[model samples]
Target: MNNKRFVILASIAALGLSGCAGYREKRGFILDEQLSQAVQVGTDNKTSVERTLGRPTFTGQFNDNEWYYVSRSTSTFAFRTPRVIDQTVLRIRFDPAGNVTAVERTGKDKIASIDPYGRTTPTLGRRKSFFEEFFGNIGTVGSGGLPGGGGQ
Candidate 1:
């Protein structure tokens, strides 16, 4: 009887401990401390940087002078939304000659948590009910309601 009790307790404990495990995910550039440190300003150009750190997560929106390497890790428990556990944004800026001019490293402190402004966005015009929105455009179309419709 005591052996049976002990077995049950051990099984329950094992199951409880397993429930605490969370799923972890890593995405984007996998930063290596040595490789990242190897890149030197004025010494490393686009080609060297690419050899050292691989392709950047993205380049500057307007130009190629700036490159960004981003690393992020997220963890999710059960069915909950994944939460960022770690993040790194390495920004390397190059001069017109393609030589690295600066290297900036940022951590999770740079991450932004944005909460949407509720389900619906406030619009400028007016609010209408479901029925109004459904039937509002019924008779408005094909009658020159549009500028170039030329409806008769």
Candidate 2:
């Protein structure tokens, strides 16, 4: 009986400790390292760009001619503040024939220079409350809880 109890307690302790394991994932955008060399003026084609840099993160709608390769790193500690560590954007422009015209790389340095105040006034729509977004409807029963609702 004592051995069985010890086994059960040990199992429970193991499970509890495992629950504290860190949760991490690759976050944000990251541009390919070869992008700088692969993309060049009047040399790269659509197929070549796709092959060299992989699929772009974003492509322009107005022109479908521009591609944006972006990469970002987000770190989070349990019960601690989460932050973005690095971000990079590679912009590739194509001509009417879908041939690469120019390639530009932007990084943290560009961001800092572009937004020194870190407060670019929005000229857009209204922003919703955090609780309303996370909990949906606070008054609704079985709805209000957390951002990702309970489910298996």
Candidate 3:
């Protein structure tokens, strides 16, 4: 009985530990060290870059001169918010002639934290209470002697 109880307890502990193990996921572009290294600044052009690194995750907001390769690894334990464990952003800039001008790399250190001030946006209008808003439009949206109203 003692040996059976011990085995059962150990099994339970193993199950609990497995349940607590975090899940990791990779998001976005997959970076290949060898392929990335093959890109040469001032030597490779847009076609070569695309051949070496495939299509970019995104291009510059305003122009196509800049290409970005973004990758992130995130882990979540149970119900906790997913946290980034590793991130890489590769930026390739091209000259007007399409030759690679520069190659830059950024890591998780560049991640930005943003906090919104409030849930509601301030607008140019009078504030109305819940009851006022609920009843305010009730009587105004009827066909009652107005130009568009069917009643004459």
Worst window of 10 by summed lDDT in candidate 1: 143-152
TM-score for candidate 1, residues paired by index: 0.81
What is the TM-score of each predicted model, taking all chains together? Answer: 0.81, 0.53, 0.74
For residues 11-106, write the lDDT of model 1, one tens digit per residue: 999998898788999999999999999999988999999988999999999988999999999999977889999999999999999999999999
Q: What do the candidate models score in CA lDDT, each in turn?
A: 0.92, 0.75, 0.92
Enumerate clash totals for all models, in the order shown: 0, 5, 0
Candidate 1 wrongly placed segments (more than 4 Å): 1-21, 145-152
lDDT by residue (29-145, candidate 3, tens digit) is 999988988889888999999988999999999989999999999999987899999999999999999999899999999999898879987789899999997887655555777
Name the runs in model 2 displaced over 4 angstroms.
Answer: 1-24, 28-30, 79-81, 109-152
Clashing residue pairs in candidate 2 are 29-70, 29-71, 29-72, 30-70, 30-71
Per-residue accuracy of model 2 over 1-152 as CA lDDT, tens digit each: 99999999999999987766555555545555765575778888999888887788889988799998877776666556556667778889998899988888777566543445556665587776887689876655544464555533
Return model 3's CA RMSD, one decimal: 4.2
In angstroms, the error of model 2 at 30 is 4.6
